[model samples]
Target: MRKLIPLLLLVVHHFASAQTKDERVKIDSILSVYTGRSVDGKGLLQEAITLSQQSDDYLLGQLYFKLAEEHLATGAYDSAGKYYPLSLTPLEIAGDSTLLGEAYIGMGYVLYLKGDYTQSLNYNLKAEKIFRAAKANKLLGRALKRMAGVFIAMKDYGTSEKYLSEALTIAEEEFDTINIVRTLNTLSVIYDETGDFKKVDPILKRAIALAEAIHCIRCMAISYSQWGISLHFRGQYKEAIGKYRKEYELNKLEGLTFDQYFVYQNIAEAYFELQNLTLALAYSDSAMFLAKTENAPQFIHDSYKIQYKIYKAQNNLGKALAALEMKSQYVDTLFSQEKARMQEDMKVAYETEKKEQLITLLEKENTIKVLEAEQSKQLRLYLIVVVVLLVLAAGVLFSRYRLKQRTAKLLDAKNIDLQNLNQVKDRLFAIISHDLKSPLSSFHTVTSTLNQYYGQISQADIKKYLEKLEVASKSLEDQMKNLLEWSLHQISERKLSPEVFDLKEMAETLKSFFQLSLEVKRQNMYLEIEGSIPLETDREYVQTILRNLISNAIKFTPPEGTIWLRAKTAGAEIVIEIEDTGIGIASEDFSKLFTLEADKKSIGNSPEKGTGLGLVLVKEMIEKMGGTISLASELNKGTTFTLKMTGKQQKQAA
Candidate 1:
């Protein structure tokens, strides 16, 4: 009977173990379906949690960890923080170091978000140690990156860079392109903050390229934004606008609404620098709308600041003041939020200390009670009282220190903002005063000469003066048109009105339009089109683009120079080229050709009056018409501007 009882117990144990294994598999299947999904998986996860409670500790811990991640994704940080810790004990019991490390990382992130940098670093370090021991290079790299982020938030850039460098090396070794790109971006940010801009550009370029290679849209967008910021800081507003537009397009494609808000704000600031008040106002408004929709006070504050600048530039004092007032309100709201976060961090720290004290006291009491009863009771009471008093004092001191630190940080940030705002204002004012005043001064000079010397001037001199006036008027009209068209292109109100147009006929029309300029410049223009090439695109946009390109060709070409306009069907596309046999652009100046900074530099040998706005407008129009433009130029040879657009047959086939 004794032998039979032992055998029956063994059989029952085997049966129970098998049942637990089956239940674990079921729980894992549930997690596989629901984890990381946006849909509410809480109810299903809860059911899994129930099933897991009686199963192996590893499965239970994994279920809890997944639940925490879901909560974290939905911004329910409190619930996430609560559940992450719930996973630790079960995972430790199961001796699953990998999941345990992941749980620690999750807790670290929660603490980091709560502004508990010290505790966050501790948790991340613990995870890093576990991942290192397990030879989990990917997780280890992630842990190191998290540690770096904590240090970055604490303004310890050197230490942050150290961790990031290590993580970057690990990612490179593992061929983890995503992590490599991410680490490079973080490193670039450090360089940017330290004002080592030369290092920033290469790192960001490499990161952007890697992101593109991996088809990581989000990573590419982030890299572009950081690059744009670097360019913006250097006062390259046109180049910065180009980068920001790339970011905006990617974010729009991915339906990332929140990211688009920041992109719009960035583009607005760039336009503001270029003194394009219309675009600045439009983009600022778009950012403001998104900020309001997202209920983001910091973004709202930033948007208002840009709007204030735009309104002030437009001489709308009332609107500027209103924007200023709104900005102040958001600033106050942000300050309040910061204070609240600090208080919450302090509260968390105090509660944590109290709990630790309680556990220590309980342990000490148990030890003392084993040796002496009365002494243990007195010692426990005394220890509790002393611990509480010390904790309270430390909490008070820490709160005061943190408050002072927060105030100083806020003051520093405000000072930087003020300085940047002042710089932007000065630049905008300088550009506007210089560009606008030049044309007006020319007009005043020509008109004054004609009015003052009407009787004294000969017929030939009067004709010359009248011609000068006409030239001034034409220059001002061109400038105004470029500004208006560029602004319309940015705000996206200029919709594409595509129609079938014969390329040769359009070339003839542009030739006729530029006949007078051609005659004055003593330049010959040639048109070549292959067998009635038909392009289906916005005619006005195409015309504007060609007009700008041709005008630029004429301006740069010396007397007796030749310009060629050619169009042909290439596969499903129509290719057009505007080639000028004049002093060509330097190879180094190619980047500056379609940018606002190009206005500051003379491209070719000829001394031409240009604002560089024409090329910028041409670029915008070509893009709007779903076409591309490229240029090939040599210093002393010549320059050719190429355009490729979809053919009418291709459009109709699609």
Candidate 2:
């Protein structure tokens, strides 16, 4: 026994030495061919693929997949997509589960970027099923995260949330910080949609913290963009604008036109709302330039809206209407673009499904051959062979089954995410067709009517009609704000410029504007300020935030419902609470409050149908002002919103 052990040890050593030499030779060969200033990744990948085929022959499959993946990273989507599947043929034959699944996922992601969302998802599912069968949880989580984004595009919020949550659990269990942050950003949008600001805000804060900790600029940009949008919806215009600006600054690199276009669009809206028309116009021009350059219909839609507002503000009614007409045209164009994406997505999904079924058929044939050989050999040999075959079959089938399950899970997630986007698309159309269209079309008609009646109608009648026209114009302006708010939230971040002001007076002014509204509802309204509520604040911002909240409460509450808006000193904090007896929110919705994700549904109440963004915007703005807002609500039992601003907030913290 001792002599045999020595012989085994010598053999193991020799094998290890030989393997080490082989590894060294392969590495040296790759380096020798690729090294030097003139090295080309394409050349290296091509050579590697060729050499892999000639060398060990076993590594060729993996090398092919690697070469394709490297190409994908360099934006050579066609090259990567082609080679990745070619590598898959060898991996399938070799039963190389690891490389096969990875290669499929790589192909899927590239296809998705190429606007082939269906193919991307199909491949992702194939990879997912394989990983699940292998119990490869780490890879499964990655596939789920990617699928979550695809689902978001499909307007399937529920499934997207499910996959994102599953991915988050896996990340936490594995201590994978990167996946955690990515999942959180995706999840936050859903929360924002359903008016779950509490959940949305904290998730964003955590995502930002994680991104900053790791110095991941891209993730930071995503977090900041989400954070800004949430803030914008909450009426935290200043902070939201700041976030958008940071995103713009960071993304001002080569191959970042898409990111910059959105940022510019947001900045224009933010500046417009802040009443800085010049800045708004500048950003609008910037957005338009990018839109034209990139052929992004969405950005073009936003640009025309901004230009319209700019012209209207300048009292250039002719230019304003022309811009509005242009905006309407682009809105129509963008709708078609989204439609095309949806159609392509469905087509690709169908085709990929067919291909996967074929792949499965081939795999099954292989399994059947092995089963037949084992079964024919049984008896005493038969019993032993049968058990082994059965076990192996069970293992493979179970792995395949689990992989399919996980792929289904990922697809479901992508569907839910797409549903959210679908809502945005639908809602955008709603705004254009129902909301803005009605008013702008009316604006044009009314102007024409007034002109037609000019000679026949009395000056007194004209004056009265002009007054009515003024009121109509006010409504138009208000409608335009909704679009502006949408644009600002989408594109910019916190841009607060704080100044010293009296909170009490601002509250009183808010109360004054709602006087008629209060009377109409027969609601009792109270403003409580024990002393001078002076703080460093932006007057217009304070007014807008207060107006939206107070008006919201008044609009929602039934007749005679009391609204208590109290501002007082609690240490160095000036807390403002707008409490009202209105229709309360459901508990199921608490988790999605601030998620502006494409998957979330925006809900509002009564005569004051809201942007579903007012609360989110308020939350964001208050936070930027070194303040905080909280919601205390009960369904049909009134809701209370509190905004607490810091007394000595700094100037440049954001």
lDDT of 2 by residue, 1-654 (tens): 233333433322332435445654775587567533233755665555543332332365666676777767765564465557557655764678977889888988877776678888899899889988998888999899878778777667788899888889998898888888988988998777656888987898898889888877788888888888888877778888999988877677434657788898887877777878888888889889988988877778768977887877776656765786577567657656645644453454345445544544544455455445655542243334334434534544454445346445645665665565556556555555555555566568768888887888888887877765765665566555545445343333235666788888888887887787688669999988887878776665677678778867876899989999998989987778889989876666665665444223345345434334555656666665667777888888988887877766554423
lDDT of each: 0.77, 0.69
- Model 1 scores a TM of 0.48
Predicted candidate 1, C-alpha RMSD: 18.6
Whole-structure CA lDDT of model 1: 0.77
Displacement of the residue 406 alpha carbon in candidate 1, Å? 18
* Per-residue alpha-carbon lDDT of candidate 1 for residues 499-566, written as tens digits (9 for 90 to 100): 78877898998899989989987889999877677777777788888888888888788888999999
Worst 10 residues of 1 by lDDT: 3-12
Off by over 4 Å in 2: 1-40, 46-64, 67-83, 110-121, 233-236, 246-261, 272-276, 286-654
lDDT at residue 321 of model 1 (Cα atoms): 52
